[model samples]
Target: MRTDSGLRLEADPRPPRALPPVPSAIQGDTPLSRPKKKKPRTKNTLGSASSEGLAQAPVHRPSEGSELPAKEPAEHPEEAPIQRRQRKTRLPLELETSFTQKKASNSSLLRNENGIHVEPPEEAVTQKPRRKTKKTQPAEIQYANELGVEDEDIITDEQSSPEQQSIFTAPTGISQPVGKVFVEKSRRFQAADRSELIKTTENAEVFVDVKLSWTTRDVALTVHRAFRMIGLFSHGFLAGCAVWNIVFIYVLAGDQLSNLSNLLQQYKTLAYPFQSLLYLLLALSTVSTFDRIDFAKTSVAIRNFLALDPTALASFLYFTALTLSLSQQMTSDRIHLYTPSSVNGSLWAAGVEEQVLQPWIVVNLVVALLVGLSWLFLSYWPGMDLSEELMFSSDVEEYPEKDKGLKASS
Candidate 1:
């Protein structure tokens, strides 16, 4: 381009210098270059000025990869006390950072007194072991032969061998029959001992069946004794009366005695048998009263005499005889008292007075008295001593002490 001075201002005509050749190593290593140096971190001073500044200033977040400086002690001694008071009053930046980190780390981050970093305590975790179970075996069929027979019978045909049979039959010491026999003998011995104990108890004298020992013989003997006493008294009296009657008849009318005798003879056929029976009964009663008769034999005699009551029979015969004699004396004109005077004759005819007692009447009165006495004795008569007769032994025990006392007394 031309200037006003008319000189040609030619552009520098030097060819663009050729650029130098780049090194390949430097181009290849460009991506692997070192990182840029970071600026030095600012430290948080724990002083009253910094604390006051931090309280007034808004909180600011640090960029990534930036480190906060450690806290430095106060420089001035006079400010140290005020710095500590401020530190106590206001929260520190490091403490706030640590708390934020703890929250972000889910409480895993911890801080110590000098703001040292700490890790959370480790927890032990246990895992349970799996259990193993054993498989169940199949059920077996039990047959009746398997229940009662030997083990040899339990095996299958394939297992039935001579060795198995020998193993089962080897024990010869245990004998079931011998053991059963011993048990049976033991039971029998125990039973015999028990029976002996029972027998001993039975043989011990106890007075239960006391009345069973009372035999009819004892009752018969007692009755016989009572009757014998009565008969002895009554017979002697009656015999005396009969003798007196015979004498009186002889004195009153000796000629009439034959008639009276004939009259007695007429009734003798009937009277003699009854009279003999009465005498035989009286004799038997007397014999029984005196003799020690066997009670067993007495029971047999009582059974035989069950058909007749001896006391009633004897009384009936005596009364009948008396009645016949009284009738004969009253009806017959032969048996009477003899009166020679007319007054006596009139007295006899009037039947108002009696000089002598009638023999028949005397006999009847004696018999009546005997019957009355016999009845009275029977009414008061004590029966058999059943307690004594039946008792096998006294209720009192025969102790050795009693016997010793008796011997000492003797």
Candidate 2:
């Protein structure tokens, strides 16, 4: 290492290794030369470069034993300004890699900024069979894609990544969404506490049916020509009672008010108690044994239950009718008012007062009986009761292809 002189000097072992070239986008900005950043991430993550002034990053891929990195809780500190600009444009980073990474198709012999050869991650991370999801909606797919490294935090916005964003976008438009331009929120992820774990249901190891004797859903279909009889039977019976009282007591019960009143009173004594008792029991059985008692981690059973279609329209209709009927003071007074006026074992005949109750009694019966039928107005009801599906201990999570086929067949 002599420099045009007789005297010669040996070169230093560490001759200030040359720094990597900066992207034109970041050439003017000062770079962050923090010593802590010089350390490579323990797993798969972006690498950083040394800059002069502002912490302008220049792209560098980590070495083979490189660590993994997270996204957006903090920006990729190692991403070059050009990459950032490209990323900010809503263009996918993975898409860019897909195009430029063709050479790695044959081998993992890819060179980084330092001329060090490293294994390409496209095969392992990017190119893979896409898993089928229950929901294939674009927004839902985007949300699932975010479940990669930073999956814990569901960005309430549509996000695209190599994991999602379609297997291949048209070579033109490049109109893929990348957590950039936000779409108006449609209320997908509403987590009060993102850190909170979902409340999982206590499922039995074996598939057991508590109400095996009550009736299988098939019987309901045979009788009512409806698969789910829980709703049909419960509501129809009540509606029938209302229609019966309306026709006979309200319309046919003419001048014989006293006779009609007594008949109605006798009929109601048995019917009223039965209806009330059935309502309670019906609610209980449907809630307990109707479903598998299953719920999703993100799904709130009650919220999803009510939000199926016209939110609250179904509930409002049935409940409103129920409230009106119950509030009539008729159900409460039916016992006292309809009771015979007797004293000292002597009865006085009431030809006028008792005979003129056709209007009052008719109105009372209509409201009380029709209360059960109100549920019929509810339409487009969704399967809110996930518990309907029976789960077994033998059926494990991440069901294998065979298990799925068996379940589907069953």
Count clashing residue pairs per candidate: 1, 18
> Which segments of model 1 are wrong by more than 4 Å?
1-262, 283-368, 382-410
Residue-level lDDT tens digits of model 2 in 143-205: 222222221122222322333334443221223323332223575543332112111111221
| TM-score of candidate 1 versus the correct structure, residues matched by position | 0.21
lDDT of all predictions, in order shown? 0.31, 0.34
Kindly report which residue pairs in candidate 1 clash with one another: 210-390
Name the best candidate (by lDDT): 2
Question: How well is each residue in 23-66 modelled by candidate 1, as lDDT tens digits?
Answer: 23322222122111101111212223343434423221121002
lDDT of 2: 0.34
lDDT over C-alpha atoms for residue 92 of model 2: 22
